[model samples]
Target: MKQLLILGCLFISLGLIGQSEEETEIKNTINSFFSSFHAQDSVGMTSVVSKNVVLQTIGANKQRQQVLRQENFNDLIHAITSIPDSIKFEEKLLDYSIQVDGPMANAWTPYEFWLNNTFSHCGVNSFQLFKQEGQWKIIYLIDTRRREGCANQP
Candidate 1:
């Protein structure tokens, strides 16, 4: 009976380890997605997104309403690449909660983007990720954008 108890404890420990590994993998995948954006690595970013990925950016501009697809990925890549390296877009993850179910997962990452070390905008990014063929990929993303202040609007 003692041997059986030991075996059961060992099995439980292995199961917990496996769960921790899976969580780490998912977190890494999400981090990679953000890293690609910061590096302006268009190809790398594209690789993490699904072909049918839906991207939405909400702000005061109409141009932000367009849906992004694989066909226009290059254009988006070029746009990001055009930003001067001196001007940085940093996303600080304030809080994030992720849930995984079978092949689907959803994550909410509250972030603040800084420009040249100054807080420029802040928003929350909602992501829809899918584990397809054993790899996690972002299938959809919607982010809200707001300037620091608008009281002085013209």
Candidate 2:
């Protein structure tokens, strides 16, 4: 009985170690997504996301009415690379909180957007990812943005 209990604990410990490694990989995937975004490389960005990925933004309009907006992924990608040379943009991520279960993972990141190196907005990005064919890819992403309470990460 003692030996059986010990073996069971050993297996549980190994499983947990593997789970943490998966969490790390998921986080790396998200980080890579941001890296590609900052570079304005649409192809690079697409590599980290699913083909049917859904993107949405939650924010308020000029009248202070809340709005939930969904965007076309491919159009957004095209728009990113088509931005005129006059403006520069960067979305700085503050921190990440990741959770994983089996083949699914969720990453929550707080971020601040800068346009031409000037503060623009701040929000939290929630990414739902799946381990498809042994690699993590973002499938759904929703974020909240507000003009106030932005963090000074510098």
Q: TM-score, each model?
A: 0.74, 0.88
The parts of candidate 1 lying over 4 Å away from their true place are 1-19, 60-75, 148-154
Total colliding residue pairs, candidate 2: 0
- Over 72-116, each residue of candidate 2 has an lDDT whose tens digit, in order, gives 998888888888878999888889898898899999999999999
Model 2: CA > 4 A from native: 1-12
The Cα local distance difference test for each model comes to 0.76, 0.91
Worst 10 residues of 2 by lDDT: 145-154
Tens digit of lDDT per residue, candidate 1, span 35-117? Answer: 88789887788888888887777665556453433235556678787889878787777777877777888888878777777
lDDT winner among the candidates?
2
